[model samples]
Target chain A: MKAVVVGAGFAGSLIAKVLGDNGFRVTVLEAGTETGHDEAVHRFRTALVKSPLAPYRTTVAAPSSDYLINTGPFAYSSPYLRMNGGTGTVWTGITPRMHPEDFRTADLGRGRNWPISYDDLEPYYRAAEWEIGVAADADEQRQHVPVADGYAYPMHALPRTYLDHAVASVVDGQRIDGRELLITGTPQARNGVPVSGYRPDGHLCAGYASCVPVCPENAKYTPRRTQKRWSPHIELRTRCVVNRLHADEFGRVTKVSYQRYEDDTTGRHTRHEVEADVVVLAAHAIENAKLLLMSGLANSSDQVGRNLMDHPALLTWALMPQPIGPFRGPGSTTSIDAFRAGPERATRAPFRIELGNWGWGWSAGSPDSDTAEFVAAGLRGYALRKAVADRVGRQFTLQFEIEQEADPANRVTLSEDRDALGNPRPSIHYGLSDYVKDGLLAAKRVSDQLFELLKADDYTSYKPDEERYFEHNGEPLRYWGAGHSGGTHVMGASKHDSVVDQWQRCWDHPNLYAVGCGSMPSLGTSNPSLTMAALALRTADHLVSHRAEEVRCTMSKAP
Target chain B: MDAFVELSAELTGFSAEELRSTGLVEQYAELAQDATDAELIQLWYTGVWRGQIPSARAYAEGLAWKAVGVAPPGTGAPGFGSWEHRPRRSV
Candidate 1:
C-alpha cells in the first residue's frame, strides 16, 4: 500500500511513521525547508525581533506572510511556521492532556462535544507521550486529568522553577470560584530522568530558557525527531507545497498534486503528482481548512472551514516580594490547572493559568526595558546595578489561556490573494464569543485575588491601541493568541454537521483523512498538540487495521 | 577602547575588570561609533547596537544579564535543577 502525508508536522510525521512500520511506502511532503538546530539558534540570537518565527527561514515560494489574511473584527495573529517540523519546532513543549469534561462542553450548555470521549483516547495519549518523550509525573497529572492507574510517563517531570515555588508558597491551597488554585509542574516534552527503559534522543534540557523559537540542546521533541526514525520505506520531500488533492468519481482521494520549489529565493517550482492509496492532510488547522475549501471537497455539511478556535491568553505581570530567579528555566514550568474545569464552565469557558518564569518579558519587554528606564533616569554605577537587580530579579507574569468555544462565524476562507505558487491564501474571520470573554473576566478576578494573596505589586497594563485590545463589560481588556489553533475542520459522530468523522476521515472522501487539531470539536484549556498527536496515532491504527482487513478480503476472493 | 571600557564601566556600574571579562570591549567600542554615552550604555545593557544586534555572542554577553544576576537565556548550560534555587549574584 502507498500512503501520502501532506505535511511533516507532529500529526503527519506520526502517521507516516506508523504506515512505514506497517510495510507501506509512505511519502511525507513538506512546504518549508529543513532547518538545523544550530542554524536556528544562530538565527534566533541574531534576529532583531526574537519572535517565534525568527529562527525559521521563510521562502518566497511559500511566503510565511501569506499564511493568513485576517478579515474579521479581531486579528488572528497566531503565526505558524511552514517548516519540516511545522510549528511544533517552536512550541512551548507543554503537553497537558485535555480534561475529561473538556470532551463534553456542549453538554454543559456551551460549545460542542467531541465525538470521542477521553477514555477512547487515553491509550493513544500514553503512546503519544512516549513517542514525544514527555517529562511529567502521571500521578500529579492524574490529580486533574484521569489517566490509567499507575500510568507513569516515559520520564519524570522537569524541575519546577523557583518562581513556581514562590507562587505556590502563597496560593497553592487558595480557592477561585470554589476551585482550588494548585500549582502543578507542567508536563513538557523535554528530557528529564528516563523511565521504563525509554531514553530521550537529545541532550537533557540544559535550561536554555529559549524553548519558544529554538532549543539549543535539542531537548524538546519536534516532529523532525520522528522523521529521523522513519524507515527507508518512508520518503520525505522538502519544499513541496501540496496545494490540491485529486479525488475519483467515488470521492476517494487518488492523487496528490504539489509544486516543488527548486530555489528558496526565487518563486521557481516544478508541478508534480503522486498516486496514493490513502491521503492524510496534517497541515495546520487553518491550512487544512483552506485546502479543503480550495479543492471543493469535504464540505457536504458546509462545515469545512467553520468553528475555528484558539486559546486567547490574557497576560498579567507583577513583582515578587523576593527574588524568584525569573528567566532561568523554561518559559513556564508550572501552571494553575484548577480553573480548567468546574461547574462555572457551564456559563463560561474554562482556562489554564500558566506561571511564566520568564519575568516581564512577555508583557513589558523585561530586563531590556527595565535597564532602559534606569539609564534614562541618569542612574549610574552602583545605583544602576542595584536597581536592575532588585527590579528584574523579582519580576513574574501570569498568562491566563482561556478556552474558546467553536464558533462557526469565526472561520477560515480562501482569499483572492495568492501565494507564489498561485494557491489562495487563508482569509480568517475570527472573534471571541461572550462565553470566552466571561471566562477572561473570571480569570482576571482570580488573578487579582492571587496577587493580593502574594502581596506582589501588579504592573499589568492593557493599552487601547494594541492590536488584540477590546472592551468587555465597560472594562478595557486584551488577549494575545496562545498559538493553540484548532476546530477548523471539526469531527463529530454524525456527518450532518462535522466534516470529519471520529476517525478523522472525511465523510465525503473515504481515503482522505484531515487530522490534527482541525479535527477537535472544542479546544480545551490545555495545549492542543498532545491531543492532536493522540488522534493522529488513533487514525494511523485504524488505517493500518482497515488495510489489513482489505488484504484479507482480497485473499479470500483469490480462493 | 580602554577609554571606552572605562566609560562603559562608569555608565554600566560594572568594574573595569568585569567589563574586560566580557571580551567585547573592542567590538562594542567599534559598534558604538559616534553614539552618545546613554546609547553606549543601552548597547552594553541590551546588546543592541543602534537598531541591530551585532552577533549571538554579543547578545549572550550582554551586561544586562550580569546586572540581573543570571546567565543570559539560551547561553550557558546551567545544568538541570539549577533553577530550583536562587541564582547567585553575578555582579
Candidate 2:
C-alpha cells in the first residue's frame, strides 16, 4: 500500500525507508530543508541566535525558498533547524533501548504500560537496532532482562573510558541492594572498534557539545545517511509543513495537505497537497497532539493533548577540587546510575537517575567563545591560577532527568495568537506534579549523597526554588522540558482511555496510526527518540503484515 | 498546574504547603479542561510542567482574583509580561 508519513525526524524518515524497502510507494513530508556543509552551518547558527528552525516557515503567500523557523513544540525548544534529514543531523549518536521495566511502568503501578507489550515490539526493536547500526554490548545491556543468549548487536560496543574508573573511585561502595551498585558504561551508536571497510571519518570520541548543533567531524549517523541508502521508491518533500490529514467516510486517510514555508525572511508564501492511502503522524510529541486536535481527529477521548510528559532535567553540579577534563571526550562519556532504577533509599517505588559528564560543572556554550572568556578573566595571569587549576580533574557533575508519571490534567492548547500560517501556536500548559516532586526529592537526596561521597564542593543545582527566582523576557517562566515530551495521544489497550491501540492504530479509525513518542504513557529517564524510531519500524511491519492478510483474504474469497 | 501554583507562590515567598491547599491545582485543571485550543493548554501546562511560576504570592492571588472576579491586590493585574516568562525564555 502507498503510505504517507508526516515528519522527517528519526521515526518518519525511517518509516519512509522501511516502507520503500518493502515495495510500498512512500512520500515523506518534512517541515525542514536540506543544506550542505556551509549552508547548514549558516542556518544552524542563525537558529541559535534566532530559532532552531529558520528555513521552512509554512504560510499561504511566502515563496518556497525562504528558510523558516519551526515554532512547533519540541522542535522550537532547541531552535534546532530542521534540515533534509531532520533532528538526527545534530544528535550525539548515542543509541539506547528502553529498559524492560520502562514497558511496564504504569502496569506495575510504578509507571505505566504501553499499549503494546514489550514482547510484541521486542523483535521490531531488534530489527531497528540492526538497521540503524547500533553498537550495544549484549552482556551490559541485558542487566535488567533475560535477554536471549547471543542477542545480536549491530555494531561493536564503544570502549569504556578511564572516566568510568574515576567515577567508580568515588562511588565504588555506594550502598544499594545490600551491596554496591556499580555504575557501568552504556553503548553509543557511533562507529566503535571499526566496521570492516568502513571509511574512517573523524577521531573516535571528541567531547563535542556541538553534537546537538553541528557535528563537524561527521561522526553522527543521522537519518540523511539512511535516506541515501533507501530504494528509489522513497520520496522526500522538504520545507513543507503538513496542515491537515483528510479522511474518507470509511475512516481511511485519503489525503495530506501542507503549506510550504519556502520564503519568510523576505516574505512570499506557497502551499501544496498530496493524496495517500495511509497517513502516519510522526511529528514530535507536542506537535503531533496539536495536529490531531486541529484536524479534529484522534481526540474522541478528549485526551489527545493531555497528560503531556517530559524529562525534568535538574542540573546537579558540584564545584570540583580539580577539573576532570570534561571537554576531552563526548559530552556524556560517564554516568552514575547509582539511583537510576528506583526511589532513593526507598524499597517499593523505582525511579531513574544518572550522572551527567558533559559540558563542564558550569555552562558550556561555544568552545572558541567560552575559552576566550576564561582567558580574558586573566585565569592564566591570576595569582590564584592554581585555584582555577584546582578545578581541573576534580569536578563531578550529575544531571538527573527524573520521570514524571502521567497526569491527564497537564496538556497542550492552541493560543489566541496565530503563526505565519494562521495556525494557532502551541501554548504549552504544563506543570510538575506531586509524583514528579517525589522523584525529584529522591533525586536531590541521592545526588547530595553522591556529591558528598565524591568529596565535591557544592556549586549549584536546578532545584525548583532556584528556577523560580530566575527571570527573563520580563516574565517568570521556570518550567523546563527535555524536548522529550509525550503522552498527548497515549496508547492503551482500550479506547475509553486511549486514542490508539497496542499497535498504535487509531481505535476509532483502524487505518490511521501515530508512531512516535507521543503515544508513550510515561517519560522514562532515557531519551525517547531512539525508541520512537524503533516503534516506527514496528508500525511499518504491522502495516505490511495487515496488508498481506487483506490481500490473502481477498484472493481466498474470489470465485 | 500545582507545580506552577507552588512555584509562583515560592517566587512570591508563599509557603509551599499553602500553595497546595489553596485549590490552585483544582482550578488549574479546570482552566485546562475549559481551554479552547488543545495546544494552548499544553503551553499553559509547561508553566506547571517545569514548575515555573511567577515568584509572587500576588500572582497566585491575582489568578485567584481572576477566577473569582475580584481585583488583584498586587501591582497591576496578573499580566502576561509579569508572569509569562520562563527562566531562559525571552519576551
Best by DockQ: 1
lDDT of 2 by residue, A236-341 (tens): 8876777788876656666888887666342244768887766788776767777887888877788788877777665566654434433333445435554445
Model 2 chain B weakest 10-residue run by lDDT: B82-91
True-contact fraction for model 1? 0.72
On a 0 to 1 TM-score scale, where does candidate 2 land against the true structure? 0.74
Show where candidate 2 strays beyond 4 Å. Answer: A41-81, A176-179, A194-209, A264-267, A342-351, A359-389, A462-480, A549-559, B1-91
lDDT of 1 by residue, A115-219 (tens): 899999999999999999999998888788888997889999999998888889889888767777789988999988899789789998888898998889888
Provide the TM-score for each candidate, comma-separated.
Answer: 0.97, 0.74
Number of colliding residue pairs in each model: 0, 83
lDDT of 2 at A91: 58
